[model samples]
Target: MDKELTSSIEKVRSAVKEELTHYLAEQRDYLTSIASELIPVCDALEDYLLEGGKRLRPLFAYAGFMAAGATPTRTDIRAMASLELLQACALIHDDLMDGSDTRRGKPAIHRHFESLHRQGSMSGVPEQFGAAAAVLLGDLALVWSDHMLHNAGLSHESLMAALRIHDEMRIELMAGQYLDVREAGEKEFSVERSLRIARYKSGKYTIERPLHLGAVIASPAQSEHGQLLNVLSAYGLPLGEAFQLRDDLLGIFGDPTVTGKPAGDDLREGKRTVLMAMTLEKASAPARRELQRDLGNPTLTVQRIEELRTIITETGAVAEVEKLIEGLATESKIAAQSSAIAADAQPFLLALADSAIRRSH
Candidate 1:
């Protein structure tokens, strides 16, 4: 089963990657005549888009195209590229907001430009100026993504729906961020609060909206359309929750070398995660106090993180969460199997169901 999934994903991934590369090359030429200054900005956009991991939004979009019984035309390809551009924009802004130095094992675009500035070379752009420049670059990608989508061969109605999805994704993500910030400051973080943060912030944007946006683009015709959307929601939300849960575990416990970030990042950042809330709720008094005191400390150490892990285990949160993750995966598979989504899409959908909860990073 795993082998078949790996093979299928590789084929889909190859197609998606080719489409992205073709789009980037076309974009590079388009921007070249504008200015030498614009060349570097275009280069940066191409770099990150080409270098990203997963391309999950585009993947979901691809699956949608398949489910609609359409081979990807130029328009479908453009939509796929647009999704990645939007994701790139979000990541740039997110890294800056989080004060994140690296993304997927490389210096983030802003920091990379900042380094070039600090080197005291030819042009003498200030480091802060470079960061500002990167911010503008991200904004351009965000705007351009919309432009590409608007120009794609979608009906005006379908395009509007996609735009609405884009708007909603942005608002929900921002709200989720604020919720996390506020929750971190609260004396007692609840399990319910943590789940809400995951759903609004990471889950909805990552899974739910992407899947639905694809459905909108496919524009199914019949009573089955509503049912297909509902099925996707039922599958995506839980899978998203599990994805975040695994992320919470990795945030504190995963290897920094593999994850491309410092260990204990979430612990130091003091994220009010679902895992933490669940652990807190179930843990003994002393264990709870230990978590409360240690969770957000900027000076947290590996040894302390290990101790926290021990305490969480003693509370059975890990076991409980794992069980829930399995249940969600099972449910996602069941939903996908029963859905009216095209038969050809089943393997891809099932692949996602299998992978959604099992990935470590």
Candidate 2:
């Protein structure tokens, strides 16, 4: 399943790339090529947008299109590319909101602004202004993404569906972010609690909406949509949740160099993720105390981080969570295989389910 889905996604990537390039060459053109002041900023934004990502949402949208036997067209490609732009907008804002310094091996947008402000002997610039600029830049990308979707030359129904999905994604993700921020300071973390956060924060918005958007674009009729939506939800929900769980594990244990960020960033942020919840669930009282004391403390030493890791492991939480992810992946695969969805989509759905539990980042 993973191999087949990966092949299809790779095939769709050409469309995504072409659309992004066209957006730069055409829509981003200056009034005066050499004399224009906005060209540099536009170029910088283009570079930033093209920097790095898995292009997962766009791939999902394309896969759904193919599953529904929609002919590949320029409009389809353009519509799909807008998903990536929407994702980029979300990431830029997410990084700023998290105050993250890096993403995909380079400085995040705000950090980039800050660095540019500090470079070439530029001084006396307030660092807060950099973050402010990034916020506005993200807002621009968000609006641009919506515009791209709207002008994709699709049927009014399809365009409306796409726009609705985009709007719902933004709102739901913000709600999830609020939940995340609220949960970080709590002590009584549970598996159910963490799962609730995962569903809101990543599962539905990340997987379901993209699938539905494409499904609607490809086959918006009521008679056709119910089955497709159900299959996609079945295939995406558990996989999305497991994906976030794996990411949570990686947050604490992954190599910072490979992850392209500081290790223990999630810990410092005190994310109330399933792994952390499980640690407390499986640990003894004193172990919980140690975890609470050192887990999120930025000033904690390396020794303390290691100790926290050991305690988490000793409680058997990590192993338990790993098994749960495997279970969820299997469940997704089963759902994909049994779903009364389009025959063309089954293979891709199964492959996505199988691969969701295997990603390293």
Candidate 3:
């Protein structure tokens, strides 16, 4: 990353972190006041929210606001920071749904609750208790996202505008997630379907919607900013897809230490990503048979993972995905250069394009 871009990103991260700290602290107090039993929930939520994350959604929103030629206030930042809570909701539920044991190298929300249940020697199934807790906590996070945004002190007009975008984003996120879960169960592998899943499940909310959120918040008059919004969509949509593609690559090939997940975890989970679809398309019949047999086997050994990795490489899927990422990123940058973008925000969007795709984890 360029030094200037890096600094700018760090500044946004810091500001959002501060806002989260303040917001979570208030919620913690509220929870503890209600009942001592709720203390555990508060603690878990604090840890999950405050721990490591890229804060990419909020950053994109801030960039969008900047691109709209407005300087954000603390209230604006708080509104943007609400997206993190929404993400927390998504990730916690996702972990439970995927049966993931860990996130960011720590026990996932469900597993964390499961351990608490076991430690307490609670009756009934610990796994069931954990699943229940994870679901409730995810719901709480979703609720809090709405509360935080509503109380963030935006003008009534801006609040209404932001709400519209927020609602649409959440709807798209759920639709995308459903598509992904549905696809995972099906045996067929379709590149086009995988790409669609990426766009809805992770792409739109991850980048495009955030940008739209910020842009709308900056200039609440939707009609006046239609052109700018269109331009931003043009920039954001492809970049968002590229970002997910990079994430797909990271899931398969990233180092455990950096990615905070087991290597080839996506393979074990049978994520029907574009890369996997392409590999299945191009692989020899024998190789395809091997992959089909082993792709979702949770007990896969390291040696078998290496074998699958080799097969994916031999099919040239990795190279193809990389090309796709580059092309999408280029499209994003080209859109950023449009006259619709504010002069100062153009560089941020350009640097962000690089930041989005040029990552190992």
Candidate 4:
């Protein structure tokens, strides 16, 4: 990404963090009567919210507002910041489901709670307690996101308009998550099915709906709103898919220092990503047997991981995915260039498309 675009995104991230800090403080006071012992829960929520994230959803919301010909105000930025809470909800639960131990170079929320239980010698299975805590925390984040959005100081009309998109975004995310979990258990590998998972799970919520939310807040005319949404969908949908594809690759091949997770984490979790699907389709019988034997093995060794990586590469799945990413990146750029998006917003959107596909982590 360009320095200018990076600076803009950082500003949004900083503003969101500031707003989250104030919101969390209010929650601490509001829940004071509920139970003093719940302080740890509140603290965990605060830490997870403030710790680390790309804040891409908020950035997209801001850009979408701009693209719709409105200058974003402080209120607009704060409203968009609510998306981070939603992201936290998804990620916290996702880590638990995947049995991940780390996130953003720190212990996963569930694992964090597990460690706390062990340190204090709390009763009950530590793992079960951790999982329960993570679930509640994730739910709390979801509720808080709704609170943040409604209290973001937008006009009543704008709030109503944004709420529709917000509701659908959450629903789509849950649907996608369901598909993800279901596919993980299935023995079949389908490229089409995997792409559907990518579209609903990460694609729409991450990009298209956020853009819709921002455009709705700007209150464009119906026809103009349609145009803006069409343009954004063109840019967002493909870019979002590319982003997820890159993430799948990174899960298997990226540096732990950069990705902030153990290598082959996705493999151990048995995530049914498109890259894996393609590999399964193209590998030889012996290679297929090897993958089947170890793909989901928690005890898979470093040597085994390397072997899987080699098989995936040799089967040409990596090359195919790279080609797909390039095509999608080009498509997104073309859509941005040809769109009726406002002049000022075009560059940032373009830069985002570039960054989505080109990022290493």
Candidate 5:
């Protein structure tokens, strides 16, 4: 990573944390007597938001603003920080849906609530209570994301422009997630479908939309807005796909300590990622049957995971995915270099693309 880009990302991280702290504190005071029980919900939200994350959305947003030749202000930072809340909502709901036990190496929100219910001897079913709480918490986070963005002091026109991208991003994310969950249970695999899932679920929301939001903010009235958006898409779309591909690799093979999730979690969840789809397409009959049997089995042992890993490797899926990532990465770099984005911002954008695909976690 470029030292300058790294420093800029760190600065965005710090700014987001500060903005989140202030917002949560205000909410805490506002809800103090209205419903004291909700206090813990806020606490959980804070912990989840502040605990551990790369804050990639906001950094990308900032880069987008810079790419559009706009200097950032505190209000811009606050508005950009809202992306983290949106992400929190997505993760909370995703964990609940997946029945995941942990996130960031800690008990997921629903599991945390389940433990609380059990510890307190609460009347209802702990599992149901946990699921319900997680759903509501996730909704709250989504709402708060809107609130933060609305209150960030952008002109009404700017807010509205940004909201268009924001709304589309959310819609695409939900639609993509639905497809992902639906495809997981199907026996057949399709590379095309998997790529579509990646494009919507992580790609656009993770990079393209953020960059567009910033570009809109900076040049809502500029004649070249369309061109800038196209340029950003040129870079963001491919990089986003590469990002998800890297994540697919990490879900299976990454160190738990570094990834903050259990090894082979994706296999347990039967994630229908491109890597899995491609592997399925090429594997021998026996290997395919074994994979189908154990892919989503919750009780897969460590030895079984190792066997699956060997199968994936032997089938040449890993190499193929790596080759794809490299190609997409190169494509993104070319787009970034050739785009009419501000020269001063090109290096940061390129650095971000490199970091996104090359990261271990």
Candidate 6:
């Protein structure tokens, strides 16, 4: 990305962080007023939200709003910032479901609470206590997402309009998550099925729906609405898929220091990603047996992970996923150049696509 685009992205990120800080402070005050015992919950949320994140969802939403030929107010930016809370909800639950130990180099929410339980000598299973806390925190984040958007100071019309898209996005996300968990439990894996899960789980809400949320908030005239959305979808959907594919590759091959997770964490989690599906298709019987034996083994050794990495590369799945990412990125860029996109917004959208595909974590 050029300096200008990079600067714009940073500016958006800063603004969203500011809004989140302000909103969380208000909520913190409210929670403390209700009871001092809620301090840990508030503290954890603050650390998770403010510490580090790409803020991609808000950035996409801002780009989408800009594409509608409308300037954004601070309030508009606050509404965009709300997406981060929703993302947090998803991630906290995801870590719990995947039995992840850490996130961004810190204990996962469930693990955090579990440690709290142990330290407090609280009765009952620490693990179960941790799981319950994580579930409640995730639910709190979901509720806060709605509250932030509703109070974001958009006009009634825009809020109503945005809510429709918001509701749809949430529903789609839940459905996608269900598919992801279901696919993991199945004995058979298909590249086609895995791709479908990717589309729903990580693709749509991450990119397409955020863009649509912004576009809808712009409140375009009825006649322009359908066409504008269609055009944005052309750009967002493929790019979203590409983004998720990049994530999948990183899950297996990424540097632990940069990704803030153990190497081959996705393998240990038994993620049924498209790359894994493709590997199974191309691997020899012996290689397939090796993979099936230890793919989801949490106790897997570093040497074993390296061996699995070699097996996957030898199957040519890594190269194929790279090719797919490149193709989808090209398609997104081409769609971004359409006349339907606001000229000012087009550059940022293109830049966002490049960033999405190129991120290390």
TM-scores for every candidate against the unseen true structure: 0.88, 0.90, 0.98, 0.96, 0.97, 0.98
Writing each residue's lDDT as its tens digit, candidate 5 over 33-137 gives: 689888779789989998889888988888888889877788988898999999999999999989999999999999999998999898989999999999999
RMSD of 6: 1.1
lDDT of 3 at 89: 97
Candidates ranked by TM-score, best first? 3, 6, 5, 4, 2, 1
> Which stretches of model 4 miss by more than 4 angstroms?
220-225
Model 5 alpha-carbon drift over 4 Å, by segment? 223-225
lDDT of 3 at 177: 93
What's the count of clashing pairs in each model shown?
Answer: 0, 2, 0, 0, 0, 0
lDDT of 2 by residue, 104-221 (tens): 7787888887877777346567477578878887887787787778777888877777677777877988788778777866767777878987887667777777777787788767
Task: Output the lDDT of residue 204, model 3.
Answer: 88
* Candidate 2 segments whose C-alpha is farther than 4 A from its true place: 1-5, 30-40, 120-124, 185-188, 223-225, 299-303
Where does the lowest 10-residue lDDT sum fall in candidate 6? Answer: 219-228
The deviation in Å at residue 38 for candidate 2 is 4.0
Candidate 3 segments whose C-alpha is farther than 4 A from its true place: none
Better by TM-score, candidate 6 or 1: 6
Clashes of 6: 0
How does residue 220 of candidate 1 score in lDDT?
Answer: 40
Output the worst ten-in-a-row residue range by lDDT, candidate 4.
219-228
Q: What does the lDDT come to for candidate 4?
A: 0.87
lDDT of each: 0.74, 0.75, 0.92, 0.87, 0.89, 0.92
Model 6 TM-score (2 dp): 0.98
Candidate 2 accuracy as lDDT:
0.75
Model 4 lDDT tens row, 1-361 = 6788889877878987888888889999888769998888888888888877888898889888988878788898889989999999999999998888999889999999999999999999999999999999999999999999999999988888888889999999999999999998887888999999999976798988898888889863444347778898898899899888998899899888888988888787767899999999999999998888888888888888888899999999999999999998888878777557888888888887777778777
